[model samples]
Target: MVVTHRGAQAVGRCLEFGCGTGHLTRALVDRLSIADLALNDLVGDCEPHVMARLPAGQRARFHAGPVERLDPEGTFDLIASASVVQWIPDHRCLLRDLSNRLEPGGWIALSGFGQDQFGELQALGSSASAPGYRNAGDWAAMVPQGMALMATRQIQTRMYFPTVRAVLRHLRETGVNGNAQGGWSRARLQKFEQDYDAQFGTAQGLPLTYDAVWMLARKI
Candidate 1:
């Protein structure tokens, strides 16, 4: 999405927050010629893993900390995060901070889950939802004054699993349900399975929905 707005040209400097395992980082490296790169993630251990995926001799620095605490030395041409901002509680403050860190005409591209993300799990009484989930229309209002909204996109999709247990395992393995509480007894697990099957079972299998929202803004 960032490449779509900034074109196929080179970016002078780029900053990417929540660059888990360098998925988006690798994508950006592949799609854009970023002269200098700064990567941030809350997990310090991920630094080696993210660095391993970068191109040989890539000019990059890894900042190990929550983005809120990061005090980067200079501005960036593109500040991007993928599936990360939803973990933040204050969207307004984060947006304003990131906007302030951008060079004029720089782009800020972010993607997060919408309010309906994991709707079936929420309906089944799961408290694993992220605090910053907002609908598609709500994102435009979150943009700071100096940034111009260039584009926004929202997608609703689902992945089917064989059973309720499988669905829960998928969430856990993917680290999306990190906040889920434990202590489910055999009876409780059985009841949850029955309820989920009755409520969301399809001819294919049990369904888990993902509501993804993406936004692009450029500093004026």
Candidate 2:
């Protein structure tokens, strides 16, 4: 969607924050004409995984650290991230910072979760949500100065699990294990499983929701 929106012009430089496992990096490199690509992630070990995803000779610079503290040289023609903005505590500030790094006419594309991301977990009083969960309307209001909000979209999808234990395992493997504090005694675990099943189970399985929001903006 973002590539289509930005048209077919080649980008001079592109920066992708939260390039976890290079999912978005591979997609962008495959579809966009980018002269330079920079990838950033909080985990230093993720560098190799992202690097390996690139085509044999395609070059990219990897920056390992919190993107908020990253100070890459020069401005970029595009700044993009996928499913990451929600982890930011102050997305408005990050938006302003990202906008400042954009060359005039540069574009920013981001996808994150809305307030209902983990609906089932949230309903069960889980603290598995990231800090900056904003809906489409909320994201529009977050556009910083010198930038225009071009588009925003929201999508909701549900994944079914065979059991509540499976749901918890899914969360752990997907890096959303914030709800897995150490206080879960065996009895408490059993009670939680029972309650979750009673409240949200279906003939197929238990449902977990993912509410994703996408935003695109351009520097004025």
Candidate 3:
């Protein structure tokens, strides 16, 4: 959806925020004719992982750090992210800052988890670390007047796991386990399993919910 939205306009320099493991970066390269790509991630090693996926002779610059602290040399034609932004405490401010970095008419494509992103974990009292998830509707008011929000939508999907461990592993593998904190004791793990099974288990297995909100907006 992001690449398709970007393809609607003329794309030149693109900034891919949270280019973790280069998954989305690779997809963008495969689908767009971006003249330059700037890959940013909090993880230092993400650059090489994404760099390896670029087409032969393709070149991209890398910045590793919090997106808010990232200072690029110039404005961008597109600022895109996937499953990011929710981690940042102040997305309204973050979006405003990002909108300021766009060339007029440039596009922004972002996807983040809504407030119910981890509904199961949230219900299980296992995800109390951060409580600032925003739904697509919440964003309409936060958006700066100068920018126009377009094609925004939110959806909920459930992923089934054989056991609670698989859900834990999914969070770890996706690098979104910041909520796990400290460590899980045997007793804590047992309690978690019980709670999750009792509340969220289905005929398939344990169900993990993902509430994804995606939006396409453009600087005026």
Candidate 4:
């Protein structure tokens, strides 16, 4: 979630591929004197809240669609995406596309949920015979060959809730579990809730952890 290192290099036209709520987009626009900027997200409406914070002159054009659909006519100075790549089916293609769309020596900064994200939840689900999840290393291995890896690291952040109900409620509100297909029946849902509480509940509260991976690379 934190930008560990950034260079003094100036960026001209920047594009944020998956600007979920535009939080990172706002920061980048503030940090760089970018003439043209593009913010894109699969769920187009999710960006309006973030767009409202920009000044009229700085407001960039918004593009709505999958990141893979973005057809860059020219190379950009910088491309940044935060916490969005994991959902994409072909991350390697996206990386290659970014490398192709980057001006010489352009920078690409990305952050995403690693395989270890929701480990406890995942384990509980697994033990209960739920679906499996992908690991971050799989994505890390798919980095484009020509891009020089400047830095790579994993981060873990924990969220503490007063009760298991609160934690589950947060997940529901955030649509974290919405990706699950073939909706569960009331009985199965009850079993899952019970299993999660039995496995992870604590006297004070429940501890939920998110594992994130960050990388910064430059086009060779």
Specify the highest-TM-score model's number. Answer: 1
Better of 1 and 3 by lDDT: 1
Give the lDDT of residue 196 in candidate 4.
Answer: 69
By lDDT, highest first, what's the ranking? Answer: 1, 2, 3, 4
Cα deviation at 21, candidate 3, in Å, is 1.1
Give lDDT: candidate 4, residue 27: 84
Models sorted by TM-score, best on top: 1, 2, 3, 4
Runs in model 4 deviating more than 4 A are 1-6, 126-140, 180-184
lDDT of 3 at 213: 85
Which parts of model 1 are misplaced by more than 4 Å?
Answer: none
Q: Which ten residues in a row have the lowest lDDT in candidate 3?
A: 2-11
Find the 10 residues in a row with the least total lDDT in model 2: 175-184
- How would you encode candidate 2's per-residue C-alpha lDDT over 52-150 as one tens digit per residue? 999877768999999989998999999999988888979889999999999999999999988888888888887777888899889777889899999
Model 2 CA lDDT for position 50: 94
Q: Residues 67-154, candidate 3, lDDT per residue (tens digit)?
A: 9899989999889998887777887788899999999988888888788877788777785335457788987876786898877899
Residue-wise C-alpha lDDT for candidate 1, range 171-196, written one tens digit per residue: 78888667764677899889989998
Q: Which residue segments of model 3 deviate by more than 4 Å?
A: 2-10, 128-131
